[model samples]
Target: GNQSGIPYSRGFECFDERFLGKPLVYCGTLGTIPVEVGGRPSERKEIEVGDWVVMCGGRIGKDGIHGATFSSEELRTESPAQAVQIGDPLTQRKLYEFILEARDTGLFRCITDNGAGGISCSFGEMGKYSGGCECELEGAPVKYEGLQPWEVLVSEAQERMTLAVQPEQRAAFEALAKQRDVEVAFMGTFNDSGYFTVKQEGMVVASLDMNFLYEDGCPTLDMPAVWKAPTVEAPVVPETADFSEVILALLSDLNLCSREYKSRMYDGEVKGLSVVKPFVGSQADVPSDATVLRVDYKSDRGAVLAEGINPWYSDIDTYAMTTSVIDEAVRRVIAVGGDLDRIAILDNFCWPDPVESEKTPDGAFKMAQLVRSCKALYDLTTLYKTPAVSGKDSCKNDSTRGGKKISIPPTLLISAVGQMVDVNQAVTMPFKAVDDMIYVIGETKAELGASSYYRWLAEQQGAAEAIGGQVPEVNGEQALSIYRAMNGATRQELLQSATTPTKGGLALALALATVGSGKGAEVDLSAISEGAVTALFSESNSRFLVSVKPDDAAVFESLFAGLPLILIGRVNAGEVLTIHGLATLDRETMRNRFKATLQGV
Candidate 1:
């Protein structure tokens, strides 16, 4: 999903190094926007000398000071007031409407998000765009009384925007904003003196020169780094696994199990536009590969949101890791009736400190990992012809305890937004009927290094490098073709349900689908790979598990003639899932194990 590597970046690195006590983490949707309306760059109006600087929508409070001073640092804990942004969807919808009016009426020249750095950061920069800005810091609207000038300038308030308006457009803009019932503040006016001059009432409080206040205020530091590879010992073949036990074990895995406990807490269908939700199926427990949301209640068009994450794969080979995640994201989106050409990518990276220090032992190695990931992202994205619209990065994903350092792997999240011409055409990952055939699209390989099977082995054995060899590889050209073929088949209703095999491989994927759909599966694993273990459990990139109707099976096979589409299974009326020579378990047994995966303390 992260193709160009330009839209998403390390733009916030300076702030990370300067003030992050604990780096903020991103958990929401990335830069994926609808393909049809995703805009082209338009001519930007220059900041005029007399433009009015106005604040719209939400007002400021003491809650956001740390966001300016720290970038919402100490991210995990609720200790800092700026650590979280409690959203108001109604207010957000109102602001969206107001901005639409602003866009249509040509009421604003330049706009900046009043997010990370309240007015001081956005307004201050806009001030320098023309030349300078003057006065009325005190005129800024706030939620409560008695805010310091610094507080008003730095609060990390939510649902707010700063816009530059022409002198004559002020009254009309104000009236429209009032008609929308949105709060407003006419803070100041732009000037040409190269200073961001601030005032309270009639007195000058702070007058900062444009250059020193922004560009040269903080200095950069260089640090020395050293990298050393860790020693590893080859591991023996996993003790012959008990087929049913292994299947149940995977179903019970924390990573593979249902996350409904957390996801069900959100307002998924608040606007009544969710066609395919986070949870699906008759029981509403099966996880949909992509979330399909209608653009508006009136339209049949919708957008698909699918995210790919593989932190374990990152340690073995970052390039493969990056490509694999991208492949995974695109695979899921296209499998669910999304167009391949309508794809947009967003990349979010979380890595250990690249700046060498006593706290960071292998900073250089981590930096190299980060660099390799970005290059792979660019190459894969360009190859797919999808561009990343926007992205974010958090560089210091690490912790120190008892004078020892523990750092996360170089992880990249590739989130894809794809368009579907009709919401009714979207497919969910569940068996539709008893007689349909199931196919495994794309190739399977012996790429088991950093896989969940090995991770599970490591967890049970306490040996990090015990399971060695085999890093996942993707043939980009081949992957793209396969995805296109699948999308074509899905659009034609030739495929009943399509899902990718990611974390736990084909075995886990098939089992989860069987349990989710409340149908039995009889998988014949001879055609894909040689070894039973490899065929059942090896984690392969760019692969899917799709169910197809018997009558349409020929058309589907014909569509993927050149690609690796293998007939490996079928939907059945029974409640058990059976993979010949590997595993077999009933629905209730698998369901109980997978249901409480994340519920365990």
Candidate 2:
């Protein structure tokens, strides 16, 4: 709660528990009110008989939560309840009709409906965005029936909108509103002064400097370092006969499953611009090497990608985690419909205290890894003309718990932005139909050393020592050439694509197929080499699964002549997946395993 148990008379204030050492949420403006009175007796009298009166600010207590206050206490307080009121639905509709009529008269430069915290928050934000201007509270209409000047100014009245109009347009706006039976008055003028002035009649009531009012008082924190590694059990080594089963079990693991459930919440259709909604049918959403966005009926396209390295892993292996993040982000963007050649990346770093000697060095390693990885991504993107754009960092995620301090793993969230000349040609994840050729584009190696499979499955079977190994360096030139060919190729249509990285590689690919169309796919993975199996099945970085038209195979190959684009097999017209050249399972089994693991079963 925000209320101070310690009374305000003695200069005591309630401390914000969340931001213990942070400064108080500063106060900006106090309460103020204005009203209009005048006109004829029958039709246009003072406070017109049926005219809808508009009131801006009138909230009684402190600012609302996330406003200029600390906790949720301000919203729960009972003192300001007297001033709040909601207008009748029909009356509100009539009022809006009048406002629309006034808008047709070319009266207002801008109009905004008053929401949370009434006029104070809305007006304050508007003023800040508009080069601080003075607003007169003299002619504002009130509803109190009989309220004090300050009370009238801060009452939280509903159905109010703030409008900005030039002097010459005010009369026309008023006249139009009156014609629709709505009340209108000139409350104030936009002033050049850097102060917010409130007045009653002709007397000034409250005046405050804009700078003091808008400043956020919280102090930047230098969080402490405190994290302990959890004791993990070693994984078991199954007999050769059970190897495939083990791999399948890991794929079905919930921690390695898809995130289709979470992505559906976003309203992708709001702007009527979403080409590929989050959830498709039975095919996994994972695309080839990028996710593509087609804005309109044009050929130009935009791509967005997200990637992050587990900070916990970084603590043990900084270089690997860094490389993983870069590989994953690029692959994600390219999987859908992104142009790998024109990509921009944003970096978000979350770590423990940077000032503490022990913890500072911990971050240094991750930072070094980040620099190396970023340089690699930049060089690749530059070869394709994609540049780094904007990025942000959120450090110091340390906290105290149960008498001891705990810090989150060293995590880095990286997002990539990409663009293409044509938007209509963008691809999405989901099986378009049967008989589509399934291709595994990129070189998959025997790199399961620090992979999620080894840690979660193998380690559980006393196979901890099986995880230590070096990751192979990628062939930048080959990758770049393949990307160019893909971007230049003609008649090379993509039925589906998605990135595979971190824990859910192939599983994510399958999940992506479920988005869009419900038609299931059967993929034959016998063509991929043995060494590449772990990397392909596990959530390894720098890989994509794509469905290509069989006839365009030659075009795709010619375009990616220098890259490692392996045509694995065809997407069969059925609901079963065949892998390792033998084992076969239906869509039901795949879907079941994916959902089961998520519940920790």
Q: What are the per-residue Cα lDDT tens digits for candidate 2 across 1-601?
A: 0121111100111211333222222211111112321221222211111112233222222222222121222122232434335444444555666665555554555556665555555455455544454444556665524555554445445556666666666567667766765555555554545666666777877776767677753466554433443244334433343434544676565455545444333344443444534444444433223434454445355444434444334534544565566556665555555666667666565544444455345644434544544555465545545455655444454554444445544455555666665555656556566667777677666555555655555546566445444343445556565555555542245434433444545544654453333545555554555543453445444565667677766666666665667775666556665554444545555566555553432
Q: Highest TM-score: give the candidate number.
A: 1
Worst 10 residues of 2 by lDDT: 1-10
Per residue, candidate 1 scores C-alpha lDDT tens digits across 163-249 of 898899999999999999988888888888899888888888888989887789878866553334433443456657787897788
lDDT of each: 0.77, 0.49
In lDDT terms, how accurate is model 1? 0.77
Regions of model 1 farther than 4 Å from truth:
1-25, 29-46, 68-94, 101-106, 127-132, 144-146, 192-194, 201-235, 464-467, 599-601
For model 2, the local distance difference test gives 0.49
Off by over 4 Å in 2: 1-244, 261-271, 282-313, 316-323, 340-345, 357-391, 417-424, 430-436, 462-477, 494-502, 506-535, 538-540, 573-575, 581-583, 597-601
- How big is the positional error of residue 121 in model 2, measured in Å on the Cα after superposition? 12
